[model samples]
Target: MSDEGHWFYCLKHMRVEYGPGCPNKDRMGPYDTEDRAKHALEHARERNEAWDAEDADQGS
Candidate 1:
């Protein structure tokens, strides 16, 4: 978890569908900073608390 301004994506929408709705593919962050993106990941993780949501990890 390095502080680098990047975007962290997550399939929050899919997580809600029980792995069977709308492709379960989505992105969630346009974080202005890497630190922020990481925060987003944590927030989303807390919200979804699943392995799939964790896969939503991305940097850029």
Candidate 2:
């Protein structure tokens, strides 16, 4: 790919086509290179977990 920071979206659900009514669709990065994309994906996972935990605690 010519673009170094090509966006790769997260697909949390098995079959949810992202958008309204779909599950998680929050973007976490514009990571550069394939290796960075992997890292960014990991970051996204961690970020989501932390965010969810914080929200859960807040809701309690």
Candidate 3:
């Protein structure tokens, strides 16, 4: 469960990186693949939609 060799999407620069390029708070990470990191925004939106649907299903 370590962060070594992981990829990250830097929100500040809007790019993907594989090392300690930006602050953790300003990036989304630990993605196993660079492709996933590259589509971070899309992945986030997909997760958000799934959560929103679940919330609607729960009536909350």
The TM-score leader among the candidates is 3
Q: What stretches of model 3 exceed 4 Å from their correct place?
A: 1-4
RMSD of 2: 8.4
Clashes of each: 3, 0, 0
* Greater-lDDT candidate between 1 and 2: 2
lDDT of 2 by residue, 1-55 (tens): 2223353334443221222332234443344444554466567789899999999
Ordered by lDDT, highest first, the candidates read 3, 2, 1
Off by over 4 Å in 1: 1-6, 10-25, 44-60
Estimate the TM-score of every prediction.
0.30, 0.43, 0.86
What's the CA error at residue 42 for candidate 3, in Å? Answer: 0.6
Q: Which prediction has more favorable TM-score, 2 or 3?
A: 3
Query: Which residue pairs collide in model 2, if any?
Result: none
* Candidate 1, lDDT over the whole model: 0.47
For model 1, residues 1-60, the per-residue Cα lDDT tens digits are: 322344444465422221122321365445564465446657776777665556665421
Extract clashing residue pairs from model 3: none
